[model samples]
Target: MTTLDKRQRVANPTYEPQPYSVTGYPTFRSFYPYYLGEHAHPVCLVGTTISLSVFVRALLAVLPLLSPAKQFAALRFGTQGWKSVGKLLLGGLLQGYVWAWIGHFFFERNKPATFKHPFYSLLGDLTLWKEVATLKRRP
Candidate 1:
């Protein structure tokens, strides 16, 4: 299992924060390696995939309400449609975080990258999701 072996090599037994997560990087290219390092467990990668899937579904839900012909006319159901969109967004966000956090706490045995670098962590999560979804990266 080279995948697990490689991930194991990346994982540190100590749960202490790594120096990479502590400092600000000038570009996402630098932060991406650290992001991949944090998801050292297969479960962590699975969590990321599920989280992004939920986001994709949420976007799909809103697309139906959008009117491509005009601006400020996205809601076909008027105010009610806006309310549904809000709830869908909120639900997706909360659910997605829960899965990611569970992966960190249980399988990874470490803190999430989001704790130190929110922006890059988000980018990493999306990137991981894309890779996994497209079968470009193995679980």
Candidate 2:
């Protein structure tokens, strides 16, 4: 096909996002073991911890300014409130992405497993935090 014809045709017109799932292990318990293995690198531990810490700090800074009821209100109701939350969310996401990419590419020298297992990876992160807090694991 000519370049012009290719440009005119729709690319992936039927594209749709599929639900995330792990093979074999349908539950978090079944997947936790594999998740831990992926995050064995020290960099992954520190990266995810810093990312989550930033998010919590941001949320705490803005919590006092917003009433519980206003939390669910539209962004227009309280611009400051929404902006604070937005900043936290964006900052946390950016930090997480950057740290994960750096850790995987430089420290671990492997592609992040999150690419193939998002949900499980997320849960694994939280589980890691729990383990650290309970003195079951070190970061």
Candidate 3:
């Protein structure tokens, strides 16, 4: 497999919770682990997976439109049509928003790192989704 950058490799690294201080906001490195921990619930994982998949598909669709070369490549690959993908993405976004709000308002009841540390949040979402899937398969 191709090697990842250091940031991506440790995208979901564990956190070392220090005392809440009056300094600036925690950096991405400090927030990612906490984000992962918050997504331990199976529902959260499922919601995040659905959301991210839609987000990525939407991004792919939009990217081609912005660049002719990419548009041609997408057509060649039979992935040029994007209206359905756009609708799916919208639905996914709504679902993700609901899940995130639930986590913030009821479960975690705290700020989510996705607002500040998007990359790590995505990584944590995938990791948690995998864990939840594996656990479900076990007897």
Please name the candidate that would achieve the greatest TM-score relative to the true structure: 1
Model 3 worst lDDT run, 10 consecutive residues: 12-21
lDDT of 2 by residue, 12-113 (tens): 212222223445567777666656555556677676777788777766656556556666344332357668677777888788878888887887666766
Segments in model 1 whose C-alpha atoms lie over 4 Å from true places: 1-23, 67-79
Model 1: residue 98 alpha-carbon error in angstroms: 1.0
Candidate 1: tens digits of C-alpha lDDT, residues 17-94: 345735578888777766776775667666556656666666765765675655535423325676876776677777
Q: Candidate 1 has what TM-score?
A: 0.68
Whole-model lDDT values for every prediction: 0.66, 0.63, 0.57
**How do all the candidates rank in terms of TM-score, highest first?**
1, 2, 3
The estimated TM-scores of all candidates read 0.68, 0.65, 0.49
Per residue, candidate 3 scores C-alpha lDDT tens digits across 1-139 of 2223332454343322333334634565555456655544435555676787777666666665667674445522134356656676778879887787687667655666677666766665666566445542110
Worst 10 residues of 2 by lDDT: 10-19
- The alpha-carbon lDDT assigned to residue 36 of candidate 1 equals 70
Give the residue spans of candidate 3 off by over 4 A.
1-32, 40-42, 49-81, 136-139
> What TM-score would candidate 2 get against the native?
0.65
Clashes of each: 0, 0, 0
**Model 2: lDDT of residue 134:** 56
